[model samples]
Target: MAQKKARKAESSSQRGKAQKKKAAGQAARAATRSEEVSGIQAFIKYLKEVRVEFEKITWATKKETIGVTVAVLAITFFFAAYLGLVDFSLTKILGLLY
Candidate 1:
């Protein structure tokens, strides 16, 4: 009867120790999660600041946009024609040499 009582007490003490270790591990994990959450919050704050700065910028009007677009297209067409002429000249020169 005495031996049975001793075994029960020892088992109960071991169970208490196991519960304490589990609680400590859980506390450590919570701290790690909180650090991760703080990093995400900082990133969100940075994005919000960028958005505010963009709102302060001046955008072009419709007329200015169309004017610039037309100028770009004209320049692109001129360059394409110039390059095509150069390619044709080079091919003819190469054929004569060969």
Candidate 2:
């Protein structure tokens, strides 16, 4: 009878330890979730501030904007043409090999 009581006490102790471990895990998860939420909120706030600053910025005039756009387009076309020529040369070389 005493041995049976001792076994029951041992089982209860193990159950207590498991419960403690589970509670600790839950607390750790909550802490991590809160930290993640705070980090995301901070990032969002930073983006909002950046947007506001951009709105206050003195943007380029329409003439300047058009000029910049045209320049970029021209540069893009030049690079595309350059790469296409390179690719064509390589293709020809490989074709001769086969």
Candidate 3:
């Protein structure tokens, strides 16, 4: 049983190494293929890919955008008031010390 477990682990490790080498070879081939493409062709390919990726994006609706904007404004107002209060208190304390 112990030997079986050890053999299993060894085989899995070897398989992992083989997979890594296979992936590396595929990447090398892809790089060579890309290198063979003309510059303008590569640019057009890049633009096409960008457009495809943009098509996959899920944009926020107007309602969602307005809600986020309102939330941000409220948080900003609260923080500004809090910081102003702290600054006033510190200034009063320092004035008394002087």
Candidate 4:
């Protein structure tokens, strides 16, 4: 009874391996037969798809865009001024040490 069960398991394992090999061979053949698109053509198609998708999106108005841009610029200028002050102070201290 044990030998019978062992034989059954061995047979199933062999069948599984055979099925897997058949699938792998079929996949390799299909891949070799598949037509490949060029990178530029694929990129252009992707961009067109994205543009259409963006058209579906509701974006902020020009006024909102301008407001956000101005706020970002103000924050940028403030950070730049702060960094410049720190840099100047450090440079002055280093100069005194020299």
Name the top TM-score candidate.
3
Model 1 agreement with the true structure over 1-98: per-residue lDDT tens digits = 99999999999999999999999999999998877757788899899999999999999999999999999999999999999999999999999999
> For model 2, how does the per-residue alpha-carbon lDDT over 1-98 read when each residue is reduced to its tens digit?
99999999999999999999999999999998877757788899999999999999997999999999999999999999999999999999999999
Per-residue lDDT of model 3, residues 1-98, tens digit only = 99999999999999999999999999999999877978898899999999999999999999999999999999999999999999999999999999
Among residues 3 or more apart in sequence or in different chains, the pairs in candidate 4 whose N, CA or C atoms overlap within 3 Å are none
Model 1 clashes, total count:
0
Error of 4 at 70 (Å): 0.5
- TM-score of each prediction: 0.55, 0.45, 0.65, 0.57
What lDDT tens digits, residue by residue, belong to model 4 across residues 18-93? 9999999999989976766789988999999999998999889999999999999999999999999999999999
Q: Which candidate should be chosen as best, given lDDT against the real structure?
A: 3
What TM-score does structure 3 among the candidates reach? Answer: 0.65
- For model 1 the TM-score comes to 0.55
Q: Please tell me which model should have the higher TM-score, number 2 or number 4.
A: 4
Order of quality (TM-score): 3, 4, 1, 2
**Where is model 1 poorest over a 10-residue stretch in terms of lDDT?**
33-42
Q: State the local distance difference test value for candidate 3.
A: 0.98
Angstrom error of the Cα, residue 54, model 4: value is 3.0
Model 4 scores a TM of 0.57
- Stronger candidate by lDDT (1 vs 2): 1
How many clashes in candidate 2? 0
